[model samples]
Structures are given as C-alpha cells and as structure tokens.
Target: MYGPGDVRVEEVPDPTIDEPTDAVVRVTYASVCGSDLHPYRSMAPSQNGRRMGHEAVGVVEEVGADVTALTVGDTVIVPFSWSDNTCVYCREGFNTSCVHGGFFDGAPSATQAERLRVPQADGTAVVIPEGTDESLMPSLLTLADVYLTGYHAAYTGGVSPGKTVTVIGDGAVGLLTVLAARQVGAERIILMGRHTDRTDLGREFGADDVVPERGEEGIAKVMELTGGDGSHVVVDAVGHLPAYEQAYGVLRPGGTISRVGVPQYEEAPVGMASLFGKNATLTGGPAAQRRYLEAALPQVLAGQIQPGRVFDRRLGLDDIVEAYRLMDSREALKVLIRP
Candidate 1:
C-alpha cells in the first residue's frame, strides 16, 4: 500500500467459535471500505496485508451453544462492531461503544474473509428475513455498515421534518447520508461533492441540491443554498482537516454538526472558536450499528432505499490486490469480492 499496490489475498483458516456467545459465518459478499485504505497506504506504519474489509452479508454456518438469537443457515448482516446487549452502554443505546464487548478492532481476520468468527453474535448480528431476493443482497450488505453509519449521522444530527441538512463527502457513506436524511423527512439536502457521477447518484438517492467544491468555495455555495443562514444540520462524512474545517463553516447558528468519518489520527483542528461563535452543537463517533440496522431492514426489504447501488465494481477474492488499488485511487466507489 505504501508504494501504491500492496493488497494481497491468501488462504486463511476458517474461524471457529471461541466463546459461548460467538458465531461463525460464511460470508457471501464482502466490500472494501475507505477506512481500510488509510492504514494500508497512508498511515505511517503502513501495516501491510492485514485481513481487509469491514462490511459484509452472509449465512451463519455455526453458532456457539449459548447463542440463541441466530441459527445456522440464517442469512444476516454483520456490522463492523460487535457488542453484548446486556452491557450498561447497550442498555443506554450506545451499543456501538459498549465497554465489555463492542468493536472487534485491530483483528486482521475481519468480514472481508470468506468465513468470519463474530463474537457476541446474539447482540451484534441481525437476521435477514427468509425469502429475501438474492438481487437485494447488496443493499442488505450496506445495512451492515455504511447505510447504518449514515443513518447514525442523521440521527445524531437531530434530523427531523423541515430541517435543512448539509452532507460533506460523496463517497458511499456520504451518498447514503442523503438517503437517511430523506427518510427522516429533511426538507433540503445539500450534498457537497466533486464528481459528476457521485453527485448525480446523490440526487437520485435524495439530495435536493449538490455543491461541487471544497474549502471556502464550497462553503460559499452552501451559504447561498441556505439563503445565507446556513443549514440547520451539517454532517461531516469526510474527516481530513480541510473537510473538517469546511463542515464547520457551512452551518447555521445553533445548528448541529455530526461527524462520522473515522478521524485519521487522534488530533485534528476543530475550529472550536467558529463553532462556539455559531452556538452550534458537535456530535458523532463510531456508529451505533445495531440501533440503525433494525430501522434500515424494513426500508431495504421494501425497496425504499437501494443502498447497495454504491458498489460500482465487483471482483473475485483472487483479484483482491487490484481491488484495493482501484479503491485507493478512488476509481471505484465500492468494490465487492466473492471470496
């Protein structure tokens, strides 16, 4: 990844149940995510060839004896985070940030593999109803990650009817943010993006107006769209310093800014003075994946939102290295691999 082409796919051992609450799944579809690229290519360590991918949908092949909610052969969506519903944080609706059993981070054998050993299956995995069409698998897969994250972004923004919301970034998560905003009855969705195709798709999904600029230029455009008052809610799906600063610039007084993009590092300029001047509220973190999955299931089942449309390319697991290259260069919005 440091030199521009570093992804690799190799045979790995099948995951086995390691706990009474664990489950092993046979992945049917695995998608490469933007978060996976940074560490592989941009981070200082440049960790080479860790098990890639965070989002996937598949069928459970086996479950721990104590796992009661999920059964073998049931189709399910595996969110990027794992949790135990009985934890205090889970009881408070922050299951994503649960202290006991949430977020299986730093493990190389993630959802990208053909088989995944998912801990806390009863709380972390959601079942897809029987009789669901195979063609709809992609959208269902999204409910496991980006779609749910986007929904969390909108939810954290306090979105409701008549609110004007501005979404930064046009990646898959960004576009889904538009869809989630629309679902919550946002009146005006201003999608900020640079690509024609992605912005076009944003319109189809729900963006009322698209701003194709960045930094000060994009800030000016958003101001114009909001009648000089700025949007009521601003969502930051892009996390670098510039994008973070721009997200702050385009919000109205007392508006809420929700951040979903994984911050590249622990520190970044927040422009706290600007936010304080506007009397704005700031929120966002690792998504509450379980909280939103149940909500997205009905929409996906009814075909109200085709979240899977974000995946623009597909390849076999054997072509994994090139798949990462395409994604790293932004040549593909979402890439799926059949392992």
Candidate 2:
C-alpha cells in the first residue's frame, strides 16, 4: 500500500535468489488478509510502494545452491513469515518469532504479485504432494496464514471435546476459527457476528449458534447459550476494545481467551476485574504457520476441510486495488488474487 486506501500495482523487478537458502516462487494464488485491511483503513502506517501481501501458494521457479528440500517446479505453500526453523523459538513451535524470521510486507518481494523471493526456503516453503489437485490451491493457500491463525486461536483457547467455544468477529479468520473449533472437537461453537452471509458460512463451518448482537447484548446471548455459565473458551478474532471486552465478558471463570486479531489500539483495558478476578487466561499472537501446516495440510488435501470456500471473489493481480476496496467495503468475504 502506498498509503491508507491507496494501493497501486506497478511493474517491478522480478525476484531472484539473493541468499543461498532462498528460492524464487512463481505465485499462482494469493489473497488479501484481514490484517492487511488494517493499513488500508488507516490503522497502521505503510510505506509507499511497499510489497503488500503475505499469503500465497506457488511453484518454485528457482532454488539457491544451499536449498535442499525444495527445487525448481515444486509446488509449495509459502508461509506468511520466513524462518530458519532452526532457532530456539522455531524449534519450540514459535516459527513466527524465529530469530531470522520476518513478514512479507516491506520485504524486497511479496506474494501479492506473480513472484516471491522466499528466504529460509528449506523451512518456509512446504511442498505439496505430487499430483495434488489444483482445485485445492486456495485451501492450501489459506494454510499460509488464515487457517493457521484460526487454529492457533482454537488451540490456545483450550478447545476440546465437550468444551463450548465462542468466536468473535465474522471475517474469514473468524469463520475459519469455527472450523478449527470443530476440528478440536468443541461440543458447541457460538459465533458473534451480524452479517447474514458471513454468519451463514459460520454455520457451515460448524457454528452451533450465531449471535447478531454486539456488546452486552451479545454477551448475554452467549451466556444464555452456554446455560448462563458462558463458554469454556472464547476467541477474539477481531482485535479491538469492544471485541476484546466481549471475549472477556463471555468467558467462563478460569476459561481462556485466545485472540488472533491484530490489535488496532495502543493499550488494552485489561485489569483485575476483567481478568485476574476471573482467572481468565489470555494467549494469542501472530500465528506460527509453519508449526501448524503439518496438521492442516492433510485435511485440506483429503477434502475433509475446505477453507477455500471463504473466497467469495477472485481477481487478477492487476485488479488488486478493487480487491482491497471490496474488502474494505465489506462487499466480499475474501478475495483470491491470481498472478
């Protein structure tokens, strides 16, 4: 994004191998993330002509000499962040926090365009099985960030069989969280959202109930659904003051709140009354896509899970500006961009 609400597509130099461990990918599919809208909505600062996307699935066009796992013509899923996967944090399943890891935005090459230069290729690129169905690309693409993010929310929230899960927000990630909750065996999944179309998808994704209300009303509905005890786990997929409060309010004492939303505010109003008093555990951040891809890829491939259905619109790279506008205006669930 050049600035808030301003995204331009310009021909730029193609990506080439710069590091021995790097690989250049010919991206086949990429998508705009909910967090990408943060900068589009003026919630964050962006540099002029900054490369603008982090999710993509593609074929390796070239691999540096040191690259071992991936090779030319290999179909791969590029995780949102690049990591060496050998650092203490990566080994501990915190790939997003790897010592040498970084996001795609502001990088020399981004997935938004036709090509991407993936650093730490051995650890950052996941090879799909040979002869995998091409139709599964969108679903596999989601593994780069959205699906993993939702899985992180569910995993951190302590979702398990017989546990009630309440997911806040109705965006793509939120809907995916509903799927993640089901995968975790949550007995019930309650999604708080207002959009009819999105809530419908939430149900398809396994939400037991959809609360159109917000704030206290939404909290009361969730409590009622949980027999006045609130949910055993709550996920705030929309990071903001109200969403955070709602997530905290509709949680059972000692239950956890897993937040995957990018925080748009400077300070969260967390305190004793809202947290310590209830022993509400809070845990969530940038998802470690590499850590979760192993478990998720199979589901996508087997057709047991289809998160790609969330893409209600598809556009080419040249139409990315309208892609952003559609998302910003809430006219689309998610846009799949082909390059």
Off by over 4 Å in 1: 1-5, 44-49, 269-272
Cα RMSD of all models vs. native, in order, equals: 1.8, 1.2
Clashes of 1: 0
lDDT of 1 by residue, 1-339 (tens): 333355556676788998989999999988888777667666454545455577778899999999999989999988888888778888887887777565543464587788998888999889999999998999998887888889999999998998999999999889999999999999899999998898899999999999998889999999998889998999988777777788789989999999998876577544657787778888998888877778779888998889999999999877878788788788999897777
Candidate number of the best lDDT: 2
Could you tell me which residue pairs clash in candidate 2? Answer: none
What's the true lDDT of residue 132 in model 2? 97
* Candidate with the greatest TM-score versus the true structure: 2
Off by over 4 Å in 2: 43-47
Cα RMSD for predicted model 1: 1.8
